[model samples]
Target: MNIKIPLPASGGLLLSYKCTAACRHCMYACSAKWKADWISEEDLVNILSQLAGKILPSPYGPDNIGLSHGLHFTGGEPFLNFELLCNALEIASGFDIPSVFVETNCFWCTNDETTREKLLTLRGKGLKGIMISVNPFYLEYVPFERTERAVRIGTELFGYNAIVYQVEYYRRFKALGIQDKVSFDKYLQLENRTDFARNTEFFIMGRAPYRLTEELADLYPRYPAGSLVHMPCSPPFLRDWHNHFDNYGNFIPGFCGGITLGDCRELNDLLKNGIDLEEYPVLAYLIQDDMLGLLQFTVDRGYMVNGDGYYSKCHLCVDLRKHLNAVDGFKELKPDGFYSNLA
Candidate 1:
């Protein structure tokens, strides 16, 4: 099947990679120990401005027009720098983005009075939605009541639809009794639960490969070599309508994590004139969805496996990218954390 690249309709700004609590499942391997600066107001303004330009105006009436463009702010903990997070929301609002959301671990919520005050302030600043991260990994450091409190506050301020509870994949698998025999199709079947919780899959990148893989080995059902290639990319890259911008205003394509596609400044140009994925050799191989082919390609490029078999296709893909990232041109494709022992 030919890979289809879709136009972006929504974007996520990774406010910063610094977090108050370090979750083992974090794809970015963020923690208090990680040294990264918060995104500047100027950078946020530039990114939102460029994003606003690419958003095609809706032909429908005013009520339906703003829905064409959406924006969300996330991070190791967006609340770590509350001011910056608020500033980002303000900017997105200024651009008339239909939806402005924020994802947080809710570690900052101390009490009902405090949480209500903070969330109400954010709501007044144009925050439209709130996604509270809740799972076993987060529960380790964050109290359940904190998440509950944040949820309550969010519902009161943004209404029920605006409040979302994001549960990690492993937790969902365990909840649905599919952990022992994993299947994506099975996952899809149970995705329609009426509960506020939304099942989110773990990307076998960052700390997950090292920190959580072995412990959950029995939960991961492996695919035969090259079979994953034919398996459709989740969110189907064609419908990957979202783009992620990091602290430096670098655009990370939704289909290609860690890899920086271009700067946010070039977003409008790239969107107007779509990119040729094949131009980036690794990305080209990636979109083909052939894990065995990708492995062979890596081997041909002087990579040797460490005798450790991967838990899944993503496991193998991440390992391969770690080696490819060392090559001069591909170095910036993925972040350095993917190649390090952040755990």
Candidate 2:
């Protein structure tokens, strides 16, 4: 059977995988250790042009254009490359793309003047909003003051457009009176909790499962390798509503890390021709029979199942992809670092 996203309603463009901090639970495993490869101006133009031509699969609001469909600039952190981010916003504006925003950890917000200056520049370049990341993981690297400053200034400028990714975390950080970077352990101690993973929202893929196993294992019951066989992959994988395209040209469907539907450079062609399951065996198995099917396929190819039971189907899925990725046979598992950075 062949499959395609048809049309994605919303998506993000990853400026780069390089970040100021390496959050342990990051879905894409973005870190400071990543290479400084960023999206080229030409590639950005090509992507935005193609995106500008696409119509939403489901229309919303006054315009049905995909370019205005919740498109945001993201990365290991979009703010890391200030110039590229500014260029991207300007280019999107040239294309008449509106409602574009940027996601950030606020690590660069050193003071009120700098923050306001940067925000004003981006807004002038057609930035519609900002999503400030605030959480224990980010608090481990960025000062809470910077995040607070960003929120305050951003809300002042963008009004309701400025969004705290998780206002709950913002409130918690304020209540704690956290001023600077702190270790996750120390934050947990201050919160009087032994674990925070159970309360956080993140996908168990990329470096997350491997790096956070200890924090999550005890909280959730583990199951043997075949435990998720009967479970089908989530419906989101078959839909194109929420997705991300990376600097490396891979189109990540439904935020399923390490899984690439195809190259975004040829996105129009892929959408027109549809994906041949024969070319993407991992996605094929997953679409046909879920993670269990993928496990069976890989096991036949000599994948060794670890003795430790999986905490969820997502955990097992990442484990299976990690093995397939290391083997270097599957072309669908992408960005290489998604698996290699598991350490």
Candidate 3:
């Protein structure tokens, strides 16, 4: 069956790369050592303005005819810059966007009273939902008590429906012995599991491949050789439900996490009219699920692989992009900091 890729209805703005806690599994490799400034107020306003004028693709039809759709604010730690976060939410609220959400690790929830006050401040501005990151990786830096406090406060302020707990799959499996068909279901059925509990799979990219893979090798599952090439990337292509804009205004397709489609600041048209994936060299390869083809394409273009084996397909893909950027000046493929941890 031929599956059609839908255009994006949601947009995510990455406020900054600076983070207080450096989690091993972070896909963006965000850490305190990673120096980058927050998205300026002017840029934030411009991005939100563009999002407000966007028309939802035909797949969504007339139901969303003249409405501002989904908008999410995320970062290494959004709450780290409280003032900027509040400002961005206020701007988004001005657009009357339907879903204005924020993703955070809840590290700032030092106490229930303070947390409640902060949540109230955000809610008053325009924040609709809070997606909390919960797992062993985050627990190392952010105490479970802090996350619990935030969740309790969030439930009280935003209601259970508006609160989301993003639990990592591997951590849940490792900690609770949740694996395979029956055990996974058992984990979901646990008494503590709420309706808003969302199980997220870890991508073997960025910090995960370098920092966490070896220690958890036994628990990690391996794909059959060549399976990755045939595996479809749903979020960036199949569903095409969302795109992430970095602090610099680069539009990153969610599936190909590293590559940038275009700089929204340079291409204001992208804000009015969304990116066309087919035109991008890297994204076009991903849309077709042609990993091997991409590697070969890069090789033909004079790119070379650094290692004999990779932790996963994403590892290989990132390496290839790094080589392309270093040797051929494909700077738009990925941020230079993505290769910083590489030896």
Candidate 4:
């Protein structure tokens, strides 16, 4: 049983929410216009049950289940699915699973008592961490007050476990801020090394696709593609971005009938129907085989740079980003127990 998430990173669950704010460059285009589906409390919980290491096939032993780290939740805004989100946290807490984290745009977080209470709710769920996306591009759509409120709630709720990521991708790229690009000479001497800038291809997520013009695509090549990098691609995350239900529980995105390649509901169906995500070829490359050959492959192929060398890390597919954006890039790719028996 080759049961494993291809990338060596944490097992993540992506839940897309429909937001009131619609930005120009949205990657998944998670907004009122480009709405994806929201997973239900029932389905999301069921999946967690599977991840608790019981339902899913376990190539390694049971201890490997709890030994795994990092259960990340990202989306249009996790807060949009407050009820289900809460369910997930509380369940993870019940299981004593650590690293229950979520990434958000801070739009729904507010000074309202309900919001404070919700943040407080996560505390009970082993919510050891939270990442706030503070991209400058959101300045036009997201109110700073919302982010400020989220930060306050985060610190009060998750305490020292909160992290914030830079969101001003367009401006940074527009300014050509390639500080990481300056380290070319140090690692290139090794003939096979992976760094943040080496093989990175620039991928625009969250509001970028709509705003991306022909002129920008032309400009994308000017950036550097670092070398020898391996990271998670978009299989899992893409699989999970679905439609948000009405306050009543109806997925409003798309026809709610069609299925995208990586959407969660469809993935679930695939599972029930006997298709295993672990068996996907692309997934196998990143998550299996001790996680080193992939890194070396990236190094050998000169893909360690962000976007095939021309774009930023965000531009790559989600799974691709997971593998590349891993802490320390190549080195962070770990060899889980599942690969211990490999030759």
**Worst lDDT 10-window in candidate 4:** 334-343
Stretches of candidate 4 off by over 4 Å are: 1-9, 34-36, 53-69, 112-115, 167-202, 205-210, 213-219, 222-343
Q: Write down the worst ten-residue block by lDDT for model 2.
A: 57-66
Task: For residues 120-214, write the lDDT of model 1, one tens digit per residue.
Answer: 88888877667777655675567666776777777777674344445354345346554222232333446552231334545765566667655
lDDT string for model 3 (90-202, tens) is 98878766567778888788887899999899889977767777655675576566776777788787674344445353345345553222322333354244421245555
Which candidate, 1 or 3, would have the higher lDDT against the true structure? 3
Full-model lDDT, candidate 4: 0.44
Deviation in angstroms for 4 in model 3?
14
Clashing pairs in 1: 229-289, 259-333
Query: Candidate 3: where is the Cα deviation over 4 Å?
Result: 1-7, 53-69, 167-200, 221-227, 236-239, 266-268, 271-280, 300-308, 341-343
State each model's C-alpha RMSD to the native. 6.7, 2.8, 7.1, 13.8
Q: For each candidate, what TM-score against the reference? A: 0.78, 0.92, 0.77, 0.50
Q: Per-residue error at 145 for model 1, in Å?
A: 1.8
Cα lDDT of all candidates, in order? 0.64, 0.79, 0.65, 0.44
TM-score of 3: 0.77
Residue runs of model 2 more than 4 Å from their true location after superposition: 53-69, 194-200
* Most accurate candidate by TM-score: 2
Q: How far is candidate 3 from the true structure (C-alpha RMSD, Å)?
A: 7.1
Cα shift from native, residue 251, model 2 (Å): 0.4
- Count backbone clashes in candidate 4: 68
